[model samples]
Target: MIETKDKKWSMFGHILMIILSILSLAPFVLLLVSSFTDEATALKNGYSFFPEKLSLEAYRYIAEQWELIGNGYLVSIIVTVVGTLAGVMISAMLAYTLSKHDLPGRSVLMLLLTFTLLFNGGLTSTYIVYTQIFNIKDTIFGLLLPNLLMNAYFVVMLKNYFEHTIPSALLESARIDGATEFQLFYRISIPLSVPMLVTVGMTVALNYWNDWMNGMYYLSANSNIQSIQTILNNINENIRFLQQNNVGTAMTTADLPSATVRMAVAFVGILPMLVFFPVFQKWFVKGATAGAVKE
Candidate 1:
C-alpha cells in the first residue's frame, strides 16, 4: 500500500513539473513566433502562439544594423566573461575568509557584508562615484566594475556552504600534510565547491549580459563599450523617436516593424543565455540545491 501511494505521488509530481515547464516556456515560444509574424497581422491580431501569417521583415531590419549589433555582442561577451570570473573569484575568496572561525574581525566583516545586502548608495551617488571618482566613463570597466561585481548575497551563500558543507576534519588533515593556506584553498576548497561556484558564476554572467543601466549611465551614444542590451535599448528608443516625430526617411513610420523588431532584438539578446543555460544545467541544479535538507 505504501509503495502504491509513493508511486502515485511520484507520477503526480512529474505531471506537475511538466505543466510548470510548459507555463514557463509558453511566453518565450509566443515571443519567438511573434518575431517572425507579419507586422500588420500582428498589430491587428495581437501575438499568438500560432500566427496567421509569418514574415522576415523584423529580422531583415535587424540585419541592416548588423555592424552595431556585432560590436555590441563582442562587448557583452567580454564583459560577461570577465565580470563573472572576477566577481565569482572575489566573492568566493571573501566567503572562504569569513568561513574561518578564528579569523580576526570576522564578525565585523560579516556584519558589513550583510548590511550591504540591505542597503546601497542610491543611483545618483553610485553614478557620481563611478563617473567622477573612478572615472570609468565610456570605458569597458564601466560595465564590469559597478553594482554587478562581488554581490554580498553570493558571498553569504558561499560562506554558508564553506562553513557547513565542507568537512572541517578534511581541512585539518590537509594542513597536517603541510599544505599552505593558498594550496588548501586552490587544491581542496575550490575543487569541492565547484557546484556553488558555477551557480554564482552563471548568475553573475546573466546579470552582466542583461545589464544596460551601467551603459546608459556611464557610456555615451558613440561609446565603443556598449553591450547588446544597451545597444538594443538604444535601437528601440530610436525607433520610438522616429515613430513619434515621423522622421524623414524613404519609408514611412507605418512601415517600421516596431513591435516585431522589439521581439526580434530581445530574442537575439537572450539567445546566448538560452544556449548557455542548458549546457551547464547540471551544475546549476546541483549548486542551486546544494544546501537543501534531504530528509
Candidate 2:
C-alpha cells in the first residue's frame, strides 16, 4: 500500500514539474513568435504563439541598426570577460583567506563584507565617489568597474566550499611539504574548485552582460563606449518617446516595429548566454551541492 502511494505521489510531482516547465518557457515562445510576426498582424491580432503572417522585418530593422548594436556587443563582451575573470580570481582568493581559521581579524573582515549586503552608499554618493575619486567616466573602465567586480555572497559560498568540501589534512600536508600559500591556492584549491568557479562565473558573467546602469551613468556622454544593454535601452526609450510625443510628424507609430523589434533585440542580447549555458549546465548542477558533506 505504501509503495503504491509513493509511486502515485512521484507521478504527481513529475506532472507538476512539467507544468511549471511549460509556464517558464511560455514567455520565450511568445517572444520568438512575436519577433518574427510583422508589424501589422501583431498590432491587429495581438501577440500569439502562432501568428497568421510571419515576417523578418523586426530582424531587418535590428540589422540596419547594427552599427550601434555591433559596437555595444563588443564592449559588453569585453567587460563580461574581463570582469568575470577578475571577479572569480579575487573572490576565490579572498574566500580562501577567510576560510583559514588561524587568520587574524577574519571574523571582522567577514562582518564588514556581510555589512555591504545590508547597507551601501546611496546612488548619488556612489556616483560622486566614482566620478570624483575614481574618475572612471567615459572610459572602458567605466563599463567594467561598477557592481560587477566582487560579490559578498559568492565569497561566503566559496569559503564554505573550501572549509567543508576540502579535507584539512590535504591542505596541511601541502603546507608541510613547503608549498607556498599562493602555490596551494593556484595549484590545489583552484583545480578542485572548478565546479564552484564555473557556477559562480556564470552568475558573474550574466551580471556583467546584463548591466547597463554603469554605462548610462558613467558613459553617459560617450555613446560609443556604451554596452549592448545600455544601447538597447536607449533605442527602446527613443522609439517609445518619439511615438508617444509625436516628435516626427511623418513617422507613423504603426510603421515602426517598436514592440516586435524589442523581442528581436532581446533575443540577440541573450543569444550568447543561451549558447554557453549548455556547456556550463553540468558544472552548475554539481556546484550547487559543492558545500554538502558526503559521508
Candidate 3:
C-alpha cells in the first residue's frame, strides 16, 4: 500500500514538472516566433504563438552588420573560454587550500573572502579603480576582469565539495608515498574534482557569454571590442528607435530584416550555451549534489 502511494505521488510530481517546463519555455518560443514575423505584423498583433508573416529581412540586416556583430562574437568567445579556464583553476586551487584544516590563515582567508559576498564597493569606486588605477577601460581586459575572475560563491561551493567529497585518507596516503603537495593536488584532487570544476567553469562561462553591461559601461563602439550580447543589444535598440521615429529615409522596409534578423541573432547567440549544456549537464548535476550528503 505504501509503495503504491509513493508511485502515485511520483507520477503527480512528474506531471507538475512537465507543466512547469512548458510554462518556462513558452516565452522563448514566442520570442523566436516574433523574431521571424514582419515587424509591422508583430507590432500590430503584439506577438502571437506563431509567426504572422515569414520574413528574412531581419537576418539579412544582421548579416550586413556583420563587421560589428561578428567582432562581438569573437570577443565574447575569447573572453568566455579564457575566463572559464582561468577562473575554474584559480577557484579550485583556492578552495582546495582552504579545505585543508592544517593550513594556517585558512579561516582568516575564508572569512575575508566571504565578507566580499555580503558587501562591495559601489560601481563608482569600482569604475574609478579599474579605469584610473588598473587602466582597463576600453580594453579586452575590461570585459573579462571585473566579473569573470574568482567569485565568492564558486569558491564556497568548491570548498564545500573538497571538504565533504574528497577523502582525507587519500591525501594522507599520497603524502606517505612521497607525493608533494602540488602533485597530490594536480594528480589526485583535480581528477576527483572534475565534476565540480566543470560545473563552476560552465557557470562562469555562461556569465561571461551573456554579459554586455561591462562593455556598455567601459567601452565605446570605436573601441572595436564589442561583445556578442552588446552588439545584439545595440542593434535592437537602434532599429526600435529608428522605427519609432519614422527615420526610414536611409532604410527601406524591404531592405531591413528587422524581425527575422532579430530571431536569427537570438538563435545564434544562444546556440553555444545550448550546445554546451548537454555536454556538461552530467558533470553539473554531479557537482551540484556532491556535498549534499555527508559521508
Candidate 4:
C-alpha cells in the first residue's frame, strides 16, 4: 500500500513538473519563430508561437557580419573554458582547506570571504580600482580576472560537500599511508568530489558565457577580445535603434532582416550553453543536493 501511494505521488509530481517546464519553454519557442518572420509581419502579428512565414534572410545578414561575430564567439569560448577551469580549481582548494577543522585560522578566512558576499564596494569604486589601481581596463585580463577568480557562494557549496559527504576516515587513512596533503587532494578528494566540481564548473562557465556587464565595463568595441554576448547585444541594439534614427533614408527598405538577425544572434549566442546544460545536468543536481544537507 505504501509503495502504491509513493508511486502515485511521484507520478503526479512528474506531471506538474512537465507542465511547468513547457510554460518556461514557451517564450523561447515564440522567439525562435519570430526570428524567422519579417519585421513587418512580427510587428503586425506580435510574435506568434509558430512561424507565420519561414525566412532565412536574418541568418544570412548575420553571416555577412560573421567576421566580427565569429571573433567574439571565439573569445567567449576561450574565456569561458579557461575561467571555469581556473575558478573551479581555486574554489575547490579553498573549500577543501576550509573543510578541514584542523586548519588554523580557517574560520577567520571564511569570515573574510563571506564578508564580500554581504557587502561590496559600489560599481564606481570597483571600476576605479580595476582601471586605475590594477590598470586592467580594456584588457582580456580585466574581463576574466574580476569575475573568474573566486566566488563565496561556490566556495560555501563546495565546503559543505566536502565536510558532509567526504568521510574523515578516508583522509586519515591516506595520511597514515604517507599521502601528502596535495597528493590526497589531487588523487582522492577530487575523485570523490566530481559532482560538485562539474556543477561549479558549469555554473562558472555559464556566467562567463552569458556575461555582458563585464564586457561593457572593461572592453572597447575596438578591442580584439569582445565577448559573444556583448557583440550580439551591440548588434541587436544598433539594428533596432539605428533603423528608426535613419528612417526615410536609402536604408529604410534595403532588405535588411533586422528582426530575424536578432533571433539568429540569440540562437547562436545560446547554442553553447544549450549543448552544455544537458551534459552537466545529472552531476549538477547531485552536487546541489549533496551540498544542501550539510551536517
How much is the lDDT of residue 275 in candidate 3?
Answer: 81
Clashing pairs in 2: none
C-alpha lDDT of residue 201 in model 2: 90
**Tens-digit lDDT track for model 4 on 171-262?**
78899999999998898788778888997888888888999888989888678799989999988988877666765565574455676777
- Segments in model 3 whose C-alpha atoms lie over 4 Å from true places: 252-265, 283-295
Q: Rank the candidates by lDDT, best first.
A: 1, 2, 4, 3
- Over 1-295, each residue of candidate 1 has an lDDT whose tens digit, in order, gives 9999999999999999999999999989988999999999999999999899999999999999999999999999999998998899999899999999999999999899989989988889888988899999988899999955549999999999899888888889899999998887887788778888988888898999999988998899899779999999999998899889999779789999999999998899899999988978877676556534233
lDDT for every model?
0.89, 0.85, 0.82, 0.83
lDDT, candidate 2, at 144: 73
Instruction: List clashing residue pairs in candidate 4.
Output: none
On lDDT, the stronger of 1 and 4 is 1
What TM-score, over all chains together, does every model reach? 0.94, 0.90, 0.87, 0.89
Steric clashes per prediction? 0, 0, 5, 0
Query: Which regions in candidate 4 have their CA more than 4 angstroms from the true location?
Result: 1-4, 253-256, 282-295
Per-residue lDDT tens digits for candidate 3, residues 48-125, read: 887557666566677788887778888989999988888888888888899998999988998899998898888899
- Pairs of residues at least 3 apart in sequence or in different chains that clash in candidate 3: 57-257, 58-257, 58-258, 58-261, 59-261
Q: Report the Cα lDDT for candidate 4.
A: 0.83
* Segments in model 1 whose C-alpha atoms lie over 4 Å from true places: 148-150, 285-295
Model 2, position 287: C-alpha lDDT score: 57
**Candidate that would win on lDDT:** 1
The lDDT of model 3 is 0.82
